[model samples]
Structures are given as C-alpha cells and as structure tokens.
Target: MPKNKVYIFDTTLRDGEQVPGCKLNTKEKIEIALALEELGVDIIEAGFPISSPGDFKSVSEIGAVIKNAVICGLSRAVQKDIEVAAEALKTAKRSRIHTGIGTSDFHIKSKFNSTREDILQRATQCVKWARNFTDDVEFYAEDAGRTDNEYLARVVEAVIAAGATTVNIPDTTGYCLPHQYGEKIAYLINNVPNIDKAVISCHCHNDLGLATANSIAGAMNGARQIECTINGLGERAGNTSLEEVVMVINQHHSLGFYTDIKTQQLNPLSRLVSDTMRMPVQPNKAIVGANAFSHSSGIHQDGFLKDAQTYEIINPEQVGADGSKIVLTARSGRSALAHRFQKLGFQFNRNDIDVLYEQFLKVADRKKEVEDEDLKVLANQYQTATV
Candidate 1:
C-alpha cells in the first residue's frame, strides 16, 4: 500500500462482537463481513479463531468467500492460538494472522502475572508463528496506549524484525489522551530502527470519548492503519467508530492522509452492523445517526433554513443520509416555519409569516411541535381571515 494511504482495518466482527448480547452467528458475521469488504476496508479482522468453535467457523467461512479485502483472524500469543488462526485463514485469497500480547506493566503484572521481558518474547514469537501462514501478518500490542514509549519501541522493533508487516498499537483501555497517544507513535517512529519495515496501526477504545481523536492523532503523527469497528461497537464504551474516523479524514483533507473507504457506504454499513448485531445506534451518534444532520433549536433551525452549512460541516449526502432536517418544535423560529411552509406549497411574506408564526407557536406550545399539516391549517386560517 502507498504511504499516503491509510489502511482501514475493521474489527467489527471481532472486537465489535465482544459487546455483551451483541453476539452474531457465523451467517450474520459473513453478511456483515461482505458489506465491510464493499465498504473498502483494507482488512477485516474476522474473529478470534481459538476462542470457540463458532468463531473458528465464522473466520473460516468468511475467509473462503471474501475475495477482495484481506480476511484476518485474531489470536493470542500461544502457539495453539496462532495455529488455529492460520488454519482458519487458509482459504483467504488475501489473509493476515493477527496475534499479540499485552506489553504494559499493568497487563503484564495483573492480566498475565508475567514480567515485561517474558511478555515481549511471547509477542515476538507470536509474530513469527503467524508469519508461517502468510506474509501479511499483523501484531497488536494489547494496552499499547499505556505501554512505556521506550519499552514499547523495543517491542515494536522486535516484531518488525520477526517479519511482522503491520504492528497495531492499541489503546486497549481507552486511557490515553490524543497528544499522549500521538507521542507514543511518534516515539516509535523516531526510536525504532526498523519502523519503516512495518505499517503502524492504531486500535483505540472510546472509554474516554477520545477514540476518534486519538486515532486521528496517531495517523497525523505517522501511523498508517487505523483498526476500528462500525458504529463504534466494542467492549465497554466501544471502539473507535469507523464512520467518525473516515468522515474526519474526508472532511479534513489537509491532514495529508486518505483511506479507500466509500464514505457513502458508511451510513448503510453502520446500520447493517447495528441491526445485525442487535445494537441500537444512539440517535445523536456521529455521521450515521438519524439526528447527525437534524436541527431543532430556534437559532440552529434559522441558520439551517438559510444555509445548511451554517450548522452542518458535513453534507448529509456525503455520508449517505437522506439530507439535512429542520425539525419542528416549540423552540423553532419563524424562519423554520416559513421554510416548512414553502416546502408544503405556501409562500408567505414576512408580515404573513409573523402572523402564521404566532399561531404556530400556540399550537407548538400545546403539541410540543407544529406538524406540516398544522402549519398548513394555520396558514390557511390567516388567508381565510384576510379574504
């Protein structure tokens, strides 16, 4: 891949499915995996093959059918896990075996009850084991956001030397602020001798509500691949939302990086994953949300009525949404009412609008909002009185 291109590694099937009660069967996983492929993600992290029989089956079947995007199967640092992942990805025309271990002292001491050196060795060995399957192997440093920058460079350097083509530095706990995470990636780029040999990937969580920010930081600071999930679905506060990151890069072209993602597919794919996974996307969620481009406040509605760009930075059509909306409500102003009136085939002058606005407000106060029909009723009443 070109250095200017940011590879989108979607783990909606792996980390996304980790959400409680969001478990998808093998068929559902394949259905979403196909959508992700068409959405233009560079890699699809299918599942952790060693975790269960169902996961292994999902990974294998997705690998068999997905011909475009690289199908990746996740595994821990254990030899058996690596072996299972490799077998599951054997059918992929393009495939990657993603394997890694924790590098931070917290995960080392508490999660593994092991030392830093031992964990580093396991991380290196896992890369070597994964490489036996394909040349496109990716190694993730779990909880990498908290891993010491100096020690993290050493771990990253070691894996790159072990034939790992991509190294994922993840904020497993979603703990790092944007600057702190960017500095970590920058540290590796400056300190690691063989850093150029592998693609640096960012996997961030949203526990701190900074996943998209941190992922953008990593990319701006030199990481080329971002591992994210659709609708931001994942453990706890969820993963970095794919739609957010993609749209951010789309809107901010000065960032000097681009991804192959079809921005239009983002909203549809987000809904597909949410529906198939049985996860309810928050109405106000970024990019793909129903209200992402909807305006309701009087001030906002007025500005939106004059020009959508006044309130919306992203055009709704850019992300596959229907379009911007000026939601009717008691808080809405006359400008909004007039715009709705025009849409409903009425053209009232300023004085005429003021008269209608008064009645609209009265009905809005009683009903919480004035519907289009109600606006027509109010407008016709004024016309009838004048006649």
Candidate 2:
C-alpha cells in the first residue's frame, strides 16, 4: 500500500458483537465476514478464539473461506491464547495473530497485578510466539491512551524488534482528547527506534465520543491503519465509526489521505450490520442514518430545494443514499411546500401560492405534519372553491 493509503482493519465481528444481546451464530459471522471481504477491508478481526468455542469456530471458519482480506484472531499475552489464535487462522490465505497485554498503569496494577517489566516481557514474548504461526503478527498495547508516553514508546520498540509486524495503540477507555491522542502517536513515531519496521495502527474507543476524532488525529500524526467497527458498534459507547472516518477523509480532500473502502457501499454495509446484529442506528446518526439526507426545517429545506449544496455538504449518492429529502412538516417554508407539490404533479404560480398559503397554514395548524395526501386534498378543494 502507498504511504498515503490507509488500511482499514475492521473488527466488527469481534468488537461489534460485544454489544449486549447482539451475538451472531457461526453462519451469521461468515455472512458478515464475506461481506467485509467484498467491501475491500484490508483486515478482518474475526474473533477472539480463546473467548468461546463458538467464537473459535467462527474465526476458524472465516479464515477458511475469506479469499482476499487477512483474517485475524485476537489473543491475550498467554501461550495458550496465542496457540488458539494460530490454530484458528490456519486456513487463511493471509492470516494474522493479534496478541497483546494492557499497558496502562491502571490495568497493569489493578487488572493484571503485574509490574511494568513483567508486562513488557509478556508483550515481546507473545509476539515471538505468534511469529511461529505466521509472519503477520500485530501487538496491541491495550489502553495505551493512559499509558505513559515514554513507557509506551519503549513497549512499541520492544514489540517491533521481537518480530511484530504491526503495533496497535488503542484508546481502550476512550479517555484521551484528540490532541493528546495525536501527540501520543507522534511520540511513538519520533521516539521508537524500530517504528518504521512495523505499521502503527490506531484502535480508539468512543466512551467520551472522541473515537473518530482521536483516530483521525492518530493518522495525522503517524498511524497508517485504523481499527474500527461498523456504525461505531462495540463495548460501552463503541469503537471508531468506520463510515464516519472514511467519509471525513473523503470530504476533506486537502487532508491528502485515502482509504481502500468503496464509499458507495457504506450505507448498505451499515444497514446489514445493524439488521444482522439487531442494533438500531440512531435516525440522526452521521453518514448512514435514515435522516442523514433528509431536511425538514424551513430554512434548511428551502435552501436544499434551490440547491442541495446549500444545506448539504455531501452528495447523498456518494454514500449510496437514493437522493436528498425534503420532508413536509409544519416548519417547512413555501419553497419546500412548492417543491413537494411540484413532485406530485401540481403547479402553482406566485399568486396561487399566496392564495394557498392561508389554507396550508390552517392544515399545518390542525396537524403535526402536512403529508402529501393532505396537500393534494387541499389543492383539489382550492380548485373547487375557486371554480
């Protein structure tokens, strides 16, 4: 891949399914795995093989069938976990074993009850062990957001020297501000002696609603790959939203960064993940939301009617949306009213609109929203009354 090309590491099946009650069967996992592959994701984190038998089977089956994308299985910094990840990725045309340990002091002392030295040893050892299976090994410094930058750089250098081809810096708790996260990535890029030996990847969470921002900052600083879940689905608030990040890069051409994702497939893929997982995408959610292309406010609708570019920055078709929407509501202005009426085969001149305004306001006051059916009835009644 070119230096400017960002690789999309999709962890939808692994992290996305962590949403409570959003589990998928092996067949369902395969369905999504295949879709992700067709969507041109560079890597797919199938699942954590050591977490459950079903997950192991799903990862293994996904590895067996996916043709282009690298199939990855997550594991802890333990021999058995790495072994299971390797076993699960055996059939992949391209495979990766993603293994790592928590690096933040909070997780090191409270969660692992281990010293910094011990964790460092585990991080390198896991990479070395994973190398026995394949040359594609990614070491994640879980919770690196809060980890001391100097210590984080040390850990990154050690893992790269120990044969890890990709080093992941994850904001596990989503606590870092955008500048702070970007600075951390910059520190690693400038400080790590062997940094160029491995690809720097960002895996940001959304607890504080900054995952997408933090991920972008990471890329701007040095990280070349982004680990994201579809629709921002993951534990707690969720991971970085794939569609948001991709579109942000696309819309901001001056950023000079690009990804391999097919922009048009974003909406279809978002809906697929939502439907299969039974997770609802908020109607106003960015990118793939149902109302992303809809306009109802009077000013916004009037601007959109004259020219979509007035109120809309992105062309709806750019992300596969059918078209822009001018929804009729009490807040709608004459332009929107005229636009929708014209769509339904009605034409009204300036005097006619002024004449209809009184009746339209009456219906608008009576109902919460004036639908096309109601407007048609109003138009017919006006013709009768005038006749």
Best by lDDT: 2
Q: Kindly report which residue stretches of model 2 are placed more than 4 angstroms away from their true locations once superposed.
A: 1-3
RMSD for all candidates, in order, please: 1.6, 1.4
> Which candidate tops TM-score?
2
lDDT of each residue in 1-387, candidate 2, tens digit only = 333988999999999999998999999999999989877899999999999999999999999999999999999999999999899888899999999999999999999999999999999999999999999999999999999999999999999999999999999999999999999999999999989999999999999999999999999998999999889999999999999999988988777799888888888989899999999999998999999999989899877777888989999889977778887777878888887778889888878878887788888888877888998998898788888
Worst 10 residues of 2 by lDDT: 1-10
Model 2, TM vs. native: 0.98
lDDT (Cα, tens digit) per residue for candidate 1, span 17-92? 9999999999999999999999999999999999999999999999999989999998889899999988988888
Number of clashing residue pairs in every model?
Answer: 0, 0
Q: Residue 200 in candidate 2 has what lDDT?
A: 95
